[model samples]
Target: MQQSNAYIITFSIILTVILGLLLSGTSQVLGPLQRKAEELDTRKQILGAVVDGETLRKMKANEVLEYYQNRISSIVVDIEGNKIETAPDGSPMVAEKVNVGKNYKMPAEKRVFPVFIYHAEGNPDAVESYILPVYGAGLWDEIWGYVALKTDLNTIAGVTFAHKGETPGLGARITSSDVQARYQGKEIFDETGTLQAVAMQKGEGKDYDADKHKVDGMSGATITANGVNNMVKNYLQYYSAFLEKTKSAKSSDVVALN
Candidate 1:
């Protein structure tokens, strides 16, 4: 039996409306859950810079959140490194909630950078390390990470990285534990007091001297490595003012003690 054109058209329209409503209802039900999962993963990555990846992986979701809440403190700063409590629209700015990828699209001077301070366990007053977020272009998509610095603010204590799309064995290795460990104990400043960000040289299997500001290059991932180098260098430069101010305050304290 052949259906009338009007009947077919009405049926199609009704089906489309039903499908749209179903999708909207699903989104409403899952939206908060999805957001919570993303927030948890972000916290994990940020903490990974200072803590062991294995430790993070072993913990439950609530444990991770508890650890972050107890030990981590953060602040948002502009390119000039001045603390910014309110966003451009006058809303309160939360450091953990700042989207680095979105900020990367805006002009550098207009972007707000988030700095995470890892406090000593059970002692919030004592500072342990500082973690800075970095983002940049990768070979196929975007890459980003958190870099933790020691008390001096020049030594890289640890790092944790992730990418949107990269080759499995090549560029994707940026997230590998071995690759991240290479940055441990690396110095970001030279003896001349200049901020010379640590770099990943070209090619792999080449040893770099410990005293130099370079790390082992990744095999078949030169572009990704370069992106990491540039991202770290640029973000460090952006955060230099805050670093300098912190250093000055430490110096003043030392003088007062003397």
Candidate 2:
């Protein structure tokens, strides 16, 4: 009986060590591939947000590479609106800000990819808009997305919301086509130049048109939607100087090229 007990203990130890080795090896082998997959998924979401249904369906990593190569220009900008450096073509670059409490423990230089999609036209004045990257914390996890606005930087052209995890049918409403569509063509700034963060207020009694920059808050998910509203306002405030610069450039007919 003592020998049997000893054999069982030995077997348990051996199994534990074997499992540990297998897990470590598997993680090492799959880490790069996992990262690559995430990168591709992010690209897909960004492209889907900007492109139409047909165009987005046709988009692949190689196609996205070509599109970015031909039209987009990427540059890293610091918190103070100073341009840091132009990133390498076709490489994913990180934003200069980090959200620590939201599980992004990485340094500012390591979190969030800031990609700029430039609209190219035969006539320099016909260029469309600039897309800015924004991210922040939701109730349960990290929320991230791209917001494309017109050249004026006052009107939103499109937005895409993605989250790590949030209550289904509640916070998840942020990613719904209907919810996201509400942000399309919404004004980001009032004529008085005040930034009114969009809200998901309850009831239809509130007048959004009168408010100019207001949006109807998501029903049943007020808190999560409010989180989104705050994120947009705060993140955009950080880029105010950059937006001002871009607006100023528009007045002076400065055209960015790839």
Candidate 3:
């Protein structure tokens, strides 16, 4: 009987070791593929922020990269309007010092690649806009997205939100098409030029004075939607300087050449 018991215990130990080995090997093999999937998803979100209507449906990962390559000019600028680096090839680079605020010097390859998309057949001297990336925590997990602004830098051209985990039908609505559409053409600032991040309120008819810069919150999804609003407002503050510089540069070009 004791010999039989000993055999059972040994078998259990071997099984556990085998399972562990299998899991570890699987993780190693799938890591690169998983990363590729994430990169593709990010590219899709960035493209989605800029396009409208059926154009979004037609966009694929390769198409996104191609469009960005043809239209977007990437540059790394300091908090003070000085150019730290510029990618002549327009290849996207990982933003390493993103969270370091505006104090640190962004490395040549580590700078945030701000994609500037020009309006089709629009004024050649017009400063179209820029899309900036934002990432932060939500109630259940991490959320990330892009916010595109007009040349005025006070208006929202478009926005796209995505999350790692959230309760479906509740917090996950942050990324829903209906929810994202609400932000389109929304002004981030008021007529007086004050930055007022739109909020997520509950129930009907909240006072969103046109001069105050506010939007109606998502019904039944207040917390998650508020998370979206806060993330945009906070991160955008960091780019205020960069926005001003871009506007000035565009103005100078308009005056000198045109």
Question: Please, what is the TM-score per model?
Answer: 0.91, 0.76, 0.76
Cα error, residue 71 of model 1, in Å, equals 0.5
Candidates sorted on lDDT, descending:
1, 2, 3
The reply for model 2, stretches above 4 Å from the true place, is: 1-9, 86-115, 121-127, 203-211, 254-258
RMSD of each: 2.2, 5.2, 5.2
> What lDDT is reached at residue 15 by model 3?
99
39-133, model 3: which lDDT tens digit per residue? 66666676667777358667776776676555554455544545555344655343432333232244423434344454433344444666777
User: Of the candidates shown, which would achieve the greatest TM-score relative to the real structure?
Assistant: 1
Quality of model 3 by C-alpha lDDT:
0.65
Model 3 alpha-carbon drift over 4 Å, by segment: 1-9, 77-82, 86-127, 204-212
Clashing residue pairs in candidate 2 (N, C-alpha, C atoms within 3 angstroms): 199-217, 200-217, 200-218, 201-217
Evaluate model 2: give its TM-score: 0.76
- Estimate, for each residue in 59-78, the C-alpha lDDT of model 1 and write its tens digit: 99999999999999999998
- In model 1, what is the error at residue 158, expressed in angstroms? 0.4
The model with the greatest lDDT is 1
Model 1: weakest 10-residue lDDT segment is 203-212
Order candidates by TM-score, high to low.
1, 2, 3
